[model samples]
Target: MTEIINFRAGRYKISFHILHILMTEKYENNATQVPSSDDTLLGVINYQKVPTPIYDLTRILEGSSAQQQMSDLIDLLHEREKDHVEWLNALQSSIETGTEFTKARDPHQCAFGKWYDSFKSENEDLKHILQKFDEPHKVIHSLADKLLKMAATEGKEQALKVLNQQRKSTLRLLLNLFSAAREAVSSSYKPVIVYTTLNGATPSLGFLVDSVDDALTIDESDIQSFVNDQAIKFAGELNLPRMISGLITKDDVNSLLIDPSLIDASLPEAYENEASLA
Candidate 1:
């Protein structure tokens, strides 16, 4: 088995060999400004009395130009859906009798159908939301389905509990998704900085991360090399240095294994010079 340190970057969970880890700490210092030539270089932080350049992991993995266009469009769709759902519920409540509530013409074809139909048209866009649902979306969607089922068969209070939980979950997920998407699209993206050594070198370097997670020792057999895969070859077209060497599977989830040394040569000349002098 190979020991690795797992960490979160944006929505991704990635791992690196524990041997490459120099030290982990809560980022509390502001990095000194650097020239704007390299977009990957975030800034420089003082490490062991030597200035170390901080690189943005997200920006390096996903290019700065990556469009969150799909995410924005999905948000619009969700907002419209929320409004429509609220309207439908209100309309149903206004129908004095249970029979009227049940007898009410199809909302999509009634006198106010145009209002309902508009939302229906927008629903088509949801198919484009995301081919694969992220954790947040999956949880929210699952809770919503359960909420509807419970409301129909179980007590109102019981359903309300599920609804409340969903509301909280939705809010948190929205914030996380929005922040991650924003970072992907924003011109000025600043993430949390981490300090570590390149191949256990003397001078430590700082790199940006979304957040830090637990460390784990994964089985070496679980790691699959990316050497000859067509997809990995296509990833190389992006011209990223030392991006991902292999993927580690733990608990059925795959995490990319990043080696700091892979990107050491890609650091700015000034940073390289500073490391050499140190």
Candidate 2:
């Protein structure tokens, strides 16, 4: 028998070997900023001032192509809204007789224009879709400020409790945002982030999940090799990059067992090779 950390992702009850789980931490704001190229690489988090890259495992499991499409859609929407605001401002200035408004190429090619075209075809309400972007950034910031004050005056334990509570609230708000975006685009997928270390390193990485369930032990007899499954093998080849080592069955549902070392493989070649030697 082997111990495992069970977590929920979509409708699946997934488990990782206990050895693979370094620790679990609350998701922080500094960790989730958008990255440059890789859609799965959400952003880096500071662990004791060491920057660590975070990966969206849910995106990887669902396949990168689909996630990329959704990410593009969201990006398009945000860009369109910004362009719309600028256009409206320009229109207002022209109406005030400041200057003549110059039309920028075809409006249909613009972000809002494209979104509007799709919205009309889909027959979804534009107001509701736009409203989904209203986030609680102010509330989150205020809570963060309060947390810092508590840390300075109340002490570590009390400040940690406050921080955890605030994190839960912030996570809930984030989930709402993600859920709203998915709903606006008619997608059913929902992703969450779990903080853990790769190969027992200092700075931890975040794994995108659907939801977290529980931690428990499993019988070793239930572990099965993934070598026979072509689909999983291919996923390992393309996305996870030698990450999936085996599968574990729990409640008749089989979940992939990931190797932490393979996650470390995502690092630069020099770092990965050094870590391997270490």
Candidate 3:
């Protein structure tokens, strides 16, 4: 079993041991400015006389050059989900009328697919979930050609039944994914800064996230594995490798787990002295 503190950062659920989070509060852009090439470094904050580096979790973890306005994206997703439902309805209607079914066969051509591809490749925490839609989305789009050919031999009624079955299965899955996508973004709130001063002797560090979620305990099995290829590619591309030790998205344990003990050492030693107010 593990005790974890779950939170949202750019539409992704992330968690770490509850013991690591000493306290959390509303972020107040008060970090003392410093010169560092590292973008994740949001400057330092004086906490208990120690210079604590405040990192922008949303900026670094989301794989976006600019932090996404989660609220706006939530509305966009709602509209896209509705568009997909209508897309399916139109396909059914065309099949029933014995007319040409002309629409985007290429998944990337659809409005939703365009946005999906354009979304900066999500970080490891979200890549797996987003990729789950690829096969289903492509399959749904390809249905028109397949069903239209089948209708000539199988009869309109049978073709219509096939379309309905697809609506219940593939389309339903996409809609659920859309809902989860919406939930992921809606989970965000005004940015929060979580401060940690582990055991008094360790360096205090602060993390800026979209919002904080509840703390809970769960069995070790709740921790999920990441795709090794995706993890490696993300780390290699970002160069600012996040020490995301493990990820879990089940029950109340949605989060990317990191060991707080490694946080200070993970950065360049120059960070420790950049703005040492202690």
What TM-score does model 2 achieve against the real structure?
A: 0.46
> Among these predicted structures, which one has the highest TM-score?
3
Q: Given candidate 2, what's the lDDT at residue 211?
A: 48
76-158: candidate 1 lDDT, tens digit per residue = 54564454345335433432222223222333343223432343211222323222224444444344345445656785567
Best by lDDT: 3
Q: Please give the lDDT score at residue 169 for candidate 1.
A: 66
TM-score of each: 0.51, 0.46, 0.53
- Model 1 RMSD in Å is 11.5
Model 3 regions lying over 4 Å from their true place: 65-188, 200-203, 224-242, 252-254
Candidate 3 structure quality by residue, lDDT tens digits, 190-267: 678888656845446788887677777777787765433545533111233446666776755356776666665566
Candidate 3 lDDT score relative to the true structure: 0.72
Instruction: Please tell me which model should have the higher TM-score, number 1 or number 2.
Output: 1
Q: lDDT of candidate 2 vs native?
A: 0.54
Candidate 2 has which clashing residue pairs, if any? none
For model 2, residues 1-278, the per-residue Cα lDDT tens digits are 78887765533456677766665664444564532455556666655555656666655665553346556666765565455445544544443443555534344555544555555312134346544433443344344345445555776467566655644675456446545655665443334555555546564555766545666677877888766344543222224635667778777877877766666655545433332332
What local lDDT does model 3 show for residue 102?
A: 69
